[model samples]
Target chain A: MSNRYEARFSAVGGQGVLLAGDILGLAAQKFEGRYSLQSPTYTAQVRGGPTKIDVIIDDEPVMYPKTTAINFFLSLAQGSYDAFLYDLRDDAIVVIDPVLVTKWDEKYKTYQVPVIEITKTKVGKMIMSSVLSLGIMIELTQVVSKEAIEKALLQKAPKGTEELNLKALRTGYEEAQKLLAQET
Target chain B: MSSASSEKSDIVFWQGNEVVARAAIAAGCRFYGGYPITPSSEIAAVMAELLPEVGGTFIQMEDEIAAMGTVIGASLVGKKSLTATSGPGFSLKLEHLGYACIAEVPCVIVNVMRGGPSTGLPTAPAQADVMQAKWGTHGDHPTIALAPAFHREIYLDTIKAFNISEKYRVPVIILIDEVLGHMSEGMIIPDPSEYEIIDRVKPSVPPEEYNPYDTQYGDVPPMANYFEGYRFHVTGLNHGANGFPTTVPDICHNDEVRMIQKVMKDVDTLTEYDEYMLEDAEVAVFAFGSTARGAKMAVEKARQEGLKVGLFRAITLWPFPEKVIHELGQRVKAFVVPEMNLGQMILEVERSVHKEMPIVGVNKVGGVPVPPYEILEKIKEVLQHA
Candidate 1:
């Protein structure tokens, strides 16, 4: 457990949580040269129900792929935040969308970033919120290098949307930097 | 054979289903006929996108049965063919599965198993199909099934599945749990020189003299493709040396015996297993597919506490590897079989070892994987009882 870092990205289906988790896992393996496994759980319905993807990254080969101890977590909806906050280390970092997840737990280190709002105003696409949240999650946890995440994001981004997706990512990253600066 | 697709880098992150398609193409599989089904749908999707690029054919049939029948038809034409499905789809394909069996058609079927007696849990993982793969088809038929634990093994085994099917002229089933199907992980593409690729043995006799089921060529007859200028009868009925159906007691009996013997006689070569720290162990955990992941971690944790525990993973689920289990039972105090299904393969463990040692199963259903802690607890409990 100590050798591996586990994270869960959760939201309602079609929120791009799966894609965000996929890109993060890809970055961990392809760019950062670490071992990673990503798996998702969702309802049979195509959309609307809560969905979550669990990612485990380790230096050594990951023998057990599922999450035992979550090191970092991000929830983009209230229902997700309430349902999926489990098996976390005492000091696990939690990132949430302040607008979507109104309720909060003060026990763990939490960052209230308006990821959806950032995507709507700056990125101009609601679907890009997951990408923005990924930027904030990476910055808050520093699980993977910024360069690695950016590279993976560009590779996975749809054709003709690379520049827009990068903007959303940088905006969220800058927001995270500001939050860290305030703490300092 | 190599997964040399430009879309796949030397080392890349890929879903388990995606690698199956990649490996199939690399193994020279030229025809894919499958219906879209959850978990296993990615295999068809990848095959559809890549097969055309390789001059292969991808057909989406009306139903799972037709999907299977299409693969059989394609394979009969000498194209290495494949089909993939999960749960209910797998059940529907059984009709053709048996047809492929007695007809001696060489093709691969990938069943990314979801929870089910009848679509029990479509989005969940379960290993309940252990017996189904072996005995689902009516009448007695030889079965060769492979269960792979990791993404890398999925690639290697998918290739091996086709090779085994071709070598023995039998349908090979690859049983993958839904978790393994949906999970994405990193693996390096294997080099072409690293592995051997096997093709079916074609007949050298003239077209007029060729016999598809000629026993003179030994247990496995030299097969000639349908349109390869050698036209011979192929049917699910009991076949004689001349490839025609026979009702004679001796001919029918010999056909049935040879069908099963073709696999049983070569069990040693067909068996692929993984043993971890079994030497000088008091207990052994028998597991496969995704369940093996948990069992492996439990063994490691048990080892750290100085427990004499080990893991025996059955990569080849059918052709059950009973002899190996029988030998291990003699030395070990007990065997713990953990799977997503409730005690399906545990029965096989009981049969293999007889009553020589105690055998217990840690089973679960309805989506969640059996955690390592649960397996560890069982190991401890079995040790105390043993």
Candidate 2:
């Protein structure tokens, strides 16, 4: 593992991007025993506007909370993808939900997935797309342990919908594993 | 009061504002009066939910002024009270802030600062309120304001703000910027027994003999709460020892001097600062609030490149630690002051060092913190010129 790993989750407001960042930070800090800092930025609009959160994890304390160079980037919408694409490192790993982000630069390695569709079909709710994307993020980067992410999801997920969210997470993880195997 | 577990400490992930609410509750703060404002509204939200659970009172006042009024009134009745707001709301509370100062009410006012001269950038960060927190209320009265750099200090300094307010019988301000107010990190909530909670000194004498502002008891007279069987007057006017308004020159002068001395006399004990790698450094970075986070990283990176760079972080911004700055100024060849504003605290740094040493201001005003490289570049520029 690198000494430091930085990730940015970009989506429109009300897409649960902020909660995904929160769960990722809690997973690293609480269960994985790593130091992490999460800083979020959003507009005044409550929904349908661009929002982004930066999460920096490291073995040592994170001195600079904001991400200067991104190692992992997750884009849930085309607008957020275009807005934040310049911040990614040259060799950065980028994940896009193909339904929303149809166009992208070919310089960086990118994984295209139908995140919202999988959540709707497998989890029975479109709002759980952020959780599904989180599962894909863990499978692609292994930034945090799956068990740690699962524990954080259990702790943070709403009381009545834990089972459905867990199913969404598993479906996304399995789909990503299959895609990676085919590429190799 | 909720007790901390005696067996072992529990570590939890908390945002900076949440820590303030939790620490306030743990410090026995039972009354919270606040109006909603961004970057600080969460403190009021959490307090509203948590205070009622603990049998404490949480009030959503009509405006920031009313919030300040409610906090002062609650404190006068012997309840530990606080209010939280951002830049614009803090601007509105200055009238009552002065009232709390002259009336000598013990309360806490938290300012989670955002960019502005007005309702500027509600979502962005700035440290421009450094001077306003000191002289925002219009008078020459002494002020105690603390700035915390991270979440842990947010928790600890909030409790300290309450303690100092109770100890000196004055309003204590916890000055935090937008970044620290909204960021999330992990911290261990220490055992409650480990905290030092200070309550206001209650009157010991009979009702007729009690003088609320008596200097004979060494500047801080024991206070008597309303309806507590002691009838003592309170007002914003220059009051005598008996607590009633007094226009007599001698009485007013003494009252003003005593209020200032009560805090200025204890400057040594009240001041708090952290010095990093200053023992053999040629240049030092002076910063406070969220700016120090980037400054520390700059200092570490500069040291790795064989430049003798260190950091002097001020946790207690008011009662500005002039003594420490004065002593360090004598040894360091140059000082770099970095802040989110164009240059607020740099003026204080320049004044303290007496211009004997080179002072450079690395400032940013676009509602973002000064990057570490910018500070490092300034550090190197100063060293190269020296």
lDDT score at residue A23, model 2, on the 0-100 scale: 87
**Once superposed on the true structure, which residue ranges of model 1 sit more than 4 Å away at CA?**
B1-9
TM-score for each of the candidates: 0.96, 0.96
lDDT of 2 at B305: 92
Per-residue alpha-carbon lDDT of candidate 2 for residues B116-141, written as tens digits (9 for 90 to 100): 98989998998988899999998878
Please write out the lDDT profile of model 2 over residues A1-184, one tens digit for every residue: 2266899999998999888899888888777777788988846786988888889888767777677678999998999999877667898999998899999989999999888887877788888888888889999999988888898888889999899878878887997898899899
Task: Point out the worst 10-residue segment of candidate 2 chain B by lDDT.
Answer: B1-10
* Candidate 2 Cα outliers beyond 4 Å, as residue runs: B1-9
lDDT of each: 0.89, 0.88
Span of 10 residues, lowest total lDDT, candidate 1 chain B: B1-10
lDDT, candidate 2, equals 0.88
Error of 2 at A15 (Å): 0.6
| 10 residues in a row with least lDDT, candidate 1 chain A | A41-50
**Model 2, docking class:** acceptable
